[model samples]
Target: MARGPVGQITRGTTGTNRLRRVDRWIARHPALRRAADPLVVDLGYGASGVTALELHARLARARPDVEVLGLEIDPERVSRARAQLELVRAGGASFAPDARVSFARGGFEVPVPGGRRPAVIRAFNVLRQYDEAEVPDAWSTMAARLSPDGLLVEGTCDEIGRIATWVAVGTDAAPRTLTVSLRLAGLQHPSIAAERLPKALIHHNVPGERVHAFLGALDSEWERAASVSPFGPVHRWRTALSALVDAGWPVRERSRWRLGEVTVPWEAVAPG
Candidate 1:
């Protein structure tokens, strides 16, 4: 509770590709798609910098010359990641060439070295440690650090990257949409995403909130679509999503739903 030694140390749990879904999503985002200089921030990358490195490599496929910086509140963790990246760079693996993906020490302030506002900021599993009441302020602080055409993607995910939900925000600090991505092969119910919702919507999964109503409707649709389960969970999920749209949920597209993801306009399920 003290001040966290210059920057707050998070739970520090991380693994390879633990944030792949979000990374893939960011790669295709219109903000990063048209950026002249695609600078991205991996805020609170936990004990390891693997997720940051992975994000750089993944985005490079689309942006070709994307820059990623991993920021951690714990100096020790940052030092560890810096050493690993140095070793990789010495080996000539272009994944982190010229230190395009590097580590630093910072908190919600997002202290980028040269005071550069990044085009995209991805903070996965960072705010889940804070009280829900603190989410909006955190979102504001991070969003304000984005470039005029930037986006802030903040979310939570399971360690294995099985389920994830993130809110994409514009530079004005307004959340645009919430996206839920999961593996549909064995998905029981869409609401299972509640466990991994971003700090903003995690607590709002209770009664009387739009998110609560949204999940409730998803459960209902999933039940109605159970007949399709014999074909496969994926088929059942698609059916459930169709049912949701019929029920007027303002669902995104079948293309995304086929990939086990569903995005809704922010106002649709935003907290009241």
Candidate 2:
């Protein structure tokens, strides 16, 4: 395999199932469900390969033939992931023996074997360390390596993965939508997701910015929906999201909003 451009090395702080929310979202994505090549890339899966293994397990439920490749810029991490794969193969781990997953040392270039581009690339918490100005170029580089109908899901989440936000970027490298997913049971406020916004808009969550206005609206709706909290957080959240849609926020479908999730077109919340 040709050496790709070396990207930044993250803290590699990975925890088991830390990416469940995003993985679930990706599993249900139409692009992956309908892809001719069901290859997914877990870009920068940290210190351990468990997240990649979990990704394979989760996505395999939707596409039994799905393949996952865990890419890390650090060679040591790649070697360690391969060792974990060996354990999985030997029945010493939770992953199935036939889990179609692999590890490689790669970065933004997304060097896949035989020049096969992936249908989906999940780059969670990868861009958090870079300057916001670099996000566009980084996104463009990865998007260029996608298959015809590929998707790039990039974002950040807390250490244990309760609250999360991600930007869905199309092959053109332009963000299509931004999704904020929270575990409503303990959600303090919908606007807390401002902290987990994708790198592109995290710093833009300030006065006069579109993202700021969006979050403010969400918080306001959350407060307005407080009367429904007697029913449940889920119902309260659904109500708030409905209010957002009613307020012309262009929120996505109710199916997603039901899961403590809300997505809006990038234009609705893009950085000003």
Candidate 3:
């Protein structure tokens, strides 16, 4: 193995607010809210440092002491983000002047000072370029750098923030839940999230597969819930989620349904 970062460099596509959905989910996660060390890692945070800044702003609302460390394997990208961080520190950016954010060159090995472990690691869109067979090892490598009660969030989303899906992995390196979040208004169907499924489950979205079955069920319930559309997309979304629960799907986090998001136990949609 090479003596450096454990992963390959990928497309640096990034935009403002592109990760709001996942950031919202992480902000509310117990892993950050209750951790002894409220340190968060924004691994592979693309071309700009804005996502890391946004993550800290969002997480700080819940855990005032939350610190975000943005990691990238590419040295130039790291330098560029550090420049952005300086602007923020100088109060030239929209974020807080002293936002607890930093940039470093690292990958799945998740290097930090003095063997410190992170409370949550958000590795969004970083694994899309890797072979599906490589996901477990990648996840295990990152998860090993987490605190005992920490979480590793891995997922993908569209260019805009509308549709997103992520898996919450525990320090044990086992995926616990899969969450699908979308912009309900004007959405044709809930299953559009299939296009953005995380690398771990994207290819498994096929006929006779667990994910295929789950999205199929979601689309069906979405169509069936159309009668309540007049009440607005949020209500319609809540209806579909309620029906999914009724239909025996192990859906969780009912409070988030109104936001056009639903989470299910990983086993419910893991490839079979």
Per-model TM against the reference = 0.92, 0.98, 0.98
Full ranking by TM-score: 3, 2, 1
**Residue pairs with backbone atoms closer than 3 Å in model 3 (clashes):** none
Q: Which pairs of residues collide in candidate 2?
A: none
Candidate 2 differs from the real structure by a C-alpha RMSD in angstroms, to one decimal, of 1.2
* Candidate with maximal TM-score: 3
Clashes of each: 0, 0, 0
| Tens digit per residue, CA lDDT, model 1, 1-272 | 54442335679899887888888889889889998769999999988888888898899889878899898888898999998898778875546565468888887778777878899999889889888878888888898889889999999999899899999988888999999999887778889999998888887888999999998998899889988788988888889999899989998846777778889999988888
Query: How many steric clashes does model 2 contain?
Result: 0
Which regions in candidate 3 have their CA more than 4 angstroms from the true location?
none
Better of 1 and 3 by TM-score: 3
lDDT, model 3: 0.94
What is the alpha-carbon lDDT for the whole of candidate 2?
Answer: 0.93
Error of 3 at 260 (Å): 0.7
| Candidate achieving higher lDDT, 1 or 3 | 3
Compare candidates 2 and 3 on TM-score and give the better one: 3
